[model samples]
Target: MTTTAAPEARPAERRTAPAAPPPVRRRRRRGDALGRTGPSKYLAHAGVWLYVLLLAAPLYYLVISAFKRNTDIFNQPFSPFTPLTFDNFGLAFSQASLGTAMLNSVYVTLGAELVTLLLAIPASYALARSKGAVGRMVERVFALGFLIPGFAALVPTVLLSISLGLFHTREFLILFLPASALPLTVILLTQAMRAVPAELEESAVLDGAGPLRVLWSVYVPLSVPTLTVVAILNFLSFWNEYFFSLVIIGPDAALRTAQVALPTLSIANAAQYGVLAAGIIITLVPAYLVYAVFADKMESAVLAGALKG
Candidate 1:
């Protein structure tokens, strides 16, 4: 009887409440200040646009000035699209010997790039693959060459050219240009070559291939994209080379490169902005064309190199 009475007792003991859930904490948003875009992000974007505009302004001026008469350029320097004229380009081509200078630039650039690649590839490969003290020493020496300004070498280079009777000669220009450009080329190509997998070389060798054979069959083929980048860089350097061309070739106006000729055309006492702009446009074309042709491959190669590193 007492047990039956106890069973009916106390509602407090009969039921229990379910547990409450833990509070949900929200994640903080990145690049946001008080749930809005940060000022730094806006500033960064603005700065990028500003930099782009800064870069484009000069090119815009050059194009506008190229089309304009001298008076228009002076009066309204910022105007977009002036009355177009082939006259400046024509004068640049004919009187300035810009056509010949362009041809000379092309010839010298091509020759120098070819020679630079020919020498740089093997040297880079050896430096990349070797592990000995001699290889380390050689690499160190090559790197040091970058420290010496090109101008510092000019006096000795000219003296040596004169002794070799190479002054004012195209052959001399070709040889000297490549020599001057080699250090940079080697540095770039070696860095690229080092990114290549050692397994590739090992596999080639295991297949009974020699070093040269492996280089030709495996390394060179894989490294084409890198080589293209190096070639482009070397071509640009040789194309824009001025001081050496100015001094070594020395007022042999006919032998001057496009770079050398451009400044020469500027009637220093009185600037011919139109003619100068045309020459600049002409010089820009080749580099632009080369980049356009190999842009995808070059980008891929550069990305790959970065990722490998």
Candidate 2:
């Protein structure tokens, strides 16, 4: 009976369940996204390069054509290098009176820039601090100059100069150049001046500095960035001015600026492309030189003002 009970008591083997499988991870579609993104980035770079090439092409053509013989220019339009010659430059320097014209341009530009700065600096300072309706009205009036096309004012300005006996005079041209620039200069300088801290002025005053001393010592030093921009703009405008120079200077070749002289260098039948190009290149040199020196300063000045404000 005990043996039978022991046999009956033998336990059934324990049943074991199989382990569950782990979840399958969804792989990221990174390769597909990268493939799509690659084409767009390449396309953007290509577009920028194309645009740059288009802009540079004309200047390239102009320079290439300058070196080419008249026949070669027409036959080989795409060729950049020609039998490089100084003949054109020689002719421009010797015959075009470009040297004299350069002098005239320099004189006129310097005069105009000086006059514009002299007038603009104080006006800008006043406008920056002003709070009245008069100040607002003045600003609005200055802004109107931008809206008005420069060519539209040409006739009236010429007529006014004639009436005032200012026609055919360099004095008149110098005066007029600054007058033309004043509205824009005032607007730019005023905006820049407004960005300056009031505390700077207050601190200057606390040190027993007068308004003039404070402006010269503090405001002018701080506003150098804006001033440089204004000066560069004024210089460029004055330098490249042909229309005003032509109309105001009479037929006197001696009074003509470099821009006016360059086009007239060619004879009516014999157009000298090389000489014209050389003259243009020479004219561009000063502007490029000025830009090189002042470009970083100009950016920093404006950026600093913007950040402080």
- Model 2 spans > 4 angstroms off: 1-50, 68-77, 267-271, 296-309
What TM value does model 1 have?
Answer: 0.76
What would the TM-scores of all predictions be? 0.76, 0.77
Highest lDDT: give the candidate number: 2
At residue 271, candidate 1 shows an lDDT of 66
Candidate models: Cα lDDT each: 0.75, 0.75
Cα lDDT of model 2 by residue, 103-140, tens digit: 98899999999999999899888889888999999888
Clashing pairs in 2: none
lDDT of 1 by residue, 153-259 (tens): 88888898899998886667788887766776777777778888989889889999998998789778887766876676667678888888888876666788888
Provide the lDDT at 212 for model 1: 94
RMSD of each: 16.7, 20.3
Deviation of model 1 at 185, angstroms: 2.5
On the 0 to 100 scale, the lDDT of residue 178 in model 1 is: 78
